[model samples]
Target: MNIVIVGAGLAGVSAAEELRNQGCPGQITLIGAEPHAPYERPPLSKGILLGDAEPDSTIVHDAQWYADHEVELITGVPVSEVDIDTGHVLLGDRHLPYDRLLLTTGSVPRRFPLADRSGADVVYLRTLDDALALKSRLTENLLIIGAGWIGLEVAAAARTAGGTVTVVEAADLPLAGVLGPELAPVFVDLHREHGVDLRLGTSVTAIEQRGGRTLVMLADGHQVSPDLILVGIGAEPDDHLAVKAGLDTDGGVLVDAWLRASDPHVYAAGDVANQEHPVLGRIRVEHWDTAIHQGRHAARNMLGQDDPYDRQPYFFTDQYDLGMEYVGHVGPEGYDEVVVRGELDDRVVTALWIRDNRVLAGMHLNDWDAIDPIRSWVGREADEELRNTASRLCPR
Candidate 1:
């Protein structure tokens, strides 16, 4: 059997490796948009930006390794079209046929509104090239738009490199949308402790090149002139290809519990897939753990092996001398009471969002002991007293 994977991100590469491990003794071709080999993205915002890691350190596997495993990698060639009827993918003038096709085209960085092609001052951190570009521009003063994970990671790197960093967010709190209002203040404090000027409830009204620097105007009638600017709002799934091919598409490429797309021969995984969960029902998770897990699931199903992908969701980010881990959705209503497993005074805390004596969400800051029991609580299998002891939000 011949298999073709459309992306070279962690998901696609993981799928290819799993297929090999599963003993699929046919041709496997991995197509990537980037000219470089497959690499990890997590370090790009941390060690890489801080000048501690070399560009070559992120590669998941070298060229010779791929060749040894009989995996053909075609880098810098993006699949422009997927002809489902013909069972072929078109890349420029070349075409490749596949018995099974896996779509793992991760996501693209969301750009700032004021950014333009000519505005060399604006940068993003999605690809290796993007990280390298941002690394080169870390001169003196660096302004960041959005206080999300990527943005805060960049700010940490800039501050560690002896550059004055400033973060501007439109929300009242830095991580208002993700971590909610109560826990977001910790992030603000963390940034402040690192000497970062984090301006919340502030939006960039205008950005233009003035002399040798970039002039940033905020909605509050404040102006900032910086040598470099990094925008890290978020990422949108690359689902246009799946949609154009007549597959079901929602916020992401819709997939079943088996990680197969609406089509039988085609499947989607990773950040591009909005899969059906056994417990949570339907959701689109853009976490690294989910990506790797779903990719392996898709690979298994592709090889005629049926295994349900029912794993707990987990994601974490290291920024500003703190590690934040989140599990499960906190819901829209927000937490009524936050249970602290550890004291916030020690700069380490695990806040649990509890409602009706059940754990809805859990946020860990420099604390991993709370995660295991919380994970059991989230799965609804742990003892009540164990959860009660681990969580401090018991009812009166």
Candidate 2:
């Protein structure tokens, strides 16, 4: 059997490795659009951008690993089309036939609407090249045009590099969409304490390059000039191949509980797969852990295993001295109440999102031991005693 995977990100690489490990004697082909091997993206905004870690250290697997594993690794080449009827993927001028195909085509960063101005002074931190470029230009004043995870992370890294940092967000608080209004102030305080000039409830109207510096015009009729601008609004999944193949798509490639697309021969995982998650209903997750686990589970299903991909969503973040691990899912209605264990000001706290008296999600900041307990509390009612006794919430 010939297996073809279009994308060399964590999901694609993990699927290839899992297929090989399952003793599938098939010709496996892995394709990537980027020149570099599959590398961890989380470090790009933190360690790699801050000069604390080298690019090589972030690689998922060394060059020798692929050769030793007998997997065909093609880099810097994108699969232009997928022919579902013929069961083949189209490269620029070549076609590769495959019995089974997995679409792990990650996501592309959203850019500002300004097109006339050259992006020479603007940066988007999605790929390794983008991170390196932003790192090289981190010596002067840096302005970030979002307060989401990527934007805040870049802000922290820029501040660490001695660059005067400013963040502008259309929302009233940073990460309001994900963490909600109640817990969003924690991040607001965190950035302000670090000397980050944050402009909330404001949007960038225009960006102009004048006198070698970029000027950012805001909706409030205020303007600010900075040495560089980084746009981190969000990302859209690369689901063109799936959509062109006549597969169902909404926001991302729609997949079943087994990560199988509409066509049995084709499957999807990672950021591109809008999977029908058992616990969270129909959702598409862009977290690293979800990608890794989904890749492995999808590989098993491809090999005739019927195990469902039912793992709960998980994500982590690191900024300055603060490290956080979040678990569970809270839907669109938002949480009824939030219970905090430990002092938020001290930076060692676990915030639990309670809905219908059950713990829907929990975020641990600077506290690692709460991961297991917090995960176990999901779907279970928040203990009244534990809520009051902050010390016992995440007991040692």
Candidate 3:
């Protein structure tokens, strides 16, 4: 059977590798818009931007690995459309037929509304090209729009490079959507302690080029001139192909527990898949770990393997001096209560979300102790003594 996979990000590459490993033995073609091979993106704003690592260090598989497995890699080309009825994918002028297909197009950064042709100085960081361009233009003063994970990471990088950095965010606290208000202060401290001029509850009205520098006019009638600008508000899933094909599209491409889309022939995974989580129930997540797990699980399911895809969600971010690790799901109601394992000053903080005396989800900032305990706590009854002890709420 001929299998075609569009997108060569982590999810797409994982699916292709899993297919070969499952001994499909059929022709496999992987197409990617990026010129480089599938590489880890979490480090783009951290290690690579800080000059600690090169771009090649993040590659999932080298050229030799693809050749050894007889997997074809098509880079720098995008699949314009998919012919579901004909079982084919249309490139610019080329068409390739497939018995099964996997969509792992991933996501793209959301640019600011003010970033029109007039706002040429404004930049974003998502793909390698974006990073490369931003890297080139980085100078003494850098203005950052949004204070999310990526924006803060860029701030760290800019500070390290001896650039004066300022981050503007409309929200009261950065990362309110992810770690919630209780934990966002830690990030705010990280930037402030690093000498970043953070302007919270501020929004940009317009960006104008002034004397080779960029002027960012705020809604409150304040303006800051910077040598360069980087916008990192958030990312939107690239689900155009799935939507155009008449596949079910919700927050992302809607899929069942098996990661199968509306059309059973086409499966969606990675950031693009709005898949059902067995543990979290019917919720869609855009996480790196989820992408890898779902991509492989989708491949296995495509090969007639009957494995229920219940996964404990996991993702990590490496900032200036900390590796932030998170696991499990935080309900909409939010964490019932937070327990700190380590002191903030010591740079080791593990915040646990407890409900009914059990750990629902945990966020570890520079602390690895919560990793194993969190895995075991999910889907199990609450342990009062352990929860109290683990949370350090009770007297030692």
Candidate 4:
């Protein structure tokens, strides 16, 4: 049994490890576009940008580890073509045959056309190289467009490093699309209190280079000049490979509950695979936890185990003094009322999104121990008795 995993990020790396764990003695090839070894990405926006972590600390595994495992690690070389008909992956003129192929192509940051047209040097935070470049300019004045996770996270890191950070968003609150109205305010308040100039309900009209700085013109007719412009609007799946290979793609590579693509021998995971989840419907998650678990699940199915990837969505963030872990999935209009187990003013709280008295999702704001109960509550009725079980579930 020969397996080839492309886009050697977390998902690909995790799948490779799981294949070996499953006792597969076949050839395992992991191909990556980055010249460096397979590395972690979460730290790019956090510790790495804050100057607390070394450049090489994010490396998931060194070359010797792959060599010992007998997994072919191809770095810095891009796969030119994936010939599903011939069961071969073409690297330039060379080709490697595979019995199974897993794609973890991941996502790329959404570009800002306004800034791009202006010819100003605008940066994005998706790769380690991008993080390192932003880290060097931490203390400089930054104009950040968009209030999504990446943008907000970069804003927090810049502020912590003594930089003047201004975050602009068209929405009324940051993460409004993800957290919804009931809990979105928590993030807005957190960043505002931390000295971040958050321009909510605003949009950037234009950006132009003014001498050594960039002057940003806003939709409100206001203008500000900054040393650097960083855009973190959001990210889109890098699924061109799947599309080119004649596989089903809708924003991302479409996969079934088993994490297998339209083609039986090929599968996809992580940010690039949009799976029709049995429990959660058609959902695509771009978090670190999803990447790891999805990779493992894909490996199991590849090994002849028929299991559906029904794990709940999970993501975490840390901004200033606030830390949070959000579990379960709730679309923008999925939830009606939000029940708070603790006070938001205190910052230690458990917020549950409820629709028709059923918990759609939940989050722990500075309350670390509430995640277990929160996870259990999802898809269950959020009655008075059930909502009160938070304290009993986790006493600490």
How does each model score on lDDT?
0.82, 0.86, 0.81, 0.88
Residue pairs that clash (backbone atoms under 3 angstroms), model 4: none
Per-candidate TM-scores read: 0.93, 0.95, 0.94, 0.97
When 1 and 4 are scored with lDDT, the better candidate is: 4
**Tens digits of lDDT, candidate 2, 153-174:** 9988888888899899998999
Q: TM-score winner between 2 and 4, please give it.
A: 4
Q: Which parts of model 1 have CA positions greater than 4 angstroms off?
A: 117-120, 332-336, 381-384, 391-396
Candidate 4 or 1, higher TM-score: 4
Which residue pairs in candidate 3 have backbone atoms (N, alpha carbon, C) closer than 3 angstroms, thus clashing? none
Better of 1 and 3 by lDDT: 1
Query: What lDDT does candidate 1 reach at residue 86?
Result: 92
lDDT of 1 at 134: 85
Looking at candidate 2, the ten consecutive residues that score lowest on lDDT are 387-396
Candidate 1 lDDT (Cα, 0 to 1): 0.82
- Ranking by TM-score, best first? 4, 2, 3, 1
**lDDT comparison, 3 vs 4, better candidate:** 4
Which residue runs of candidate 2 sit more than 4 Å off their true CA positions? 115-120, 383-391, 394-396
Q: By TM-score, is 1 or 3 better?
A: 3
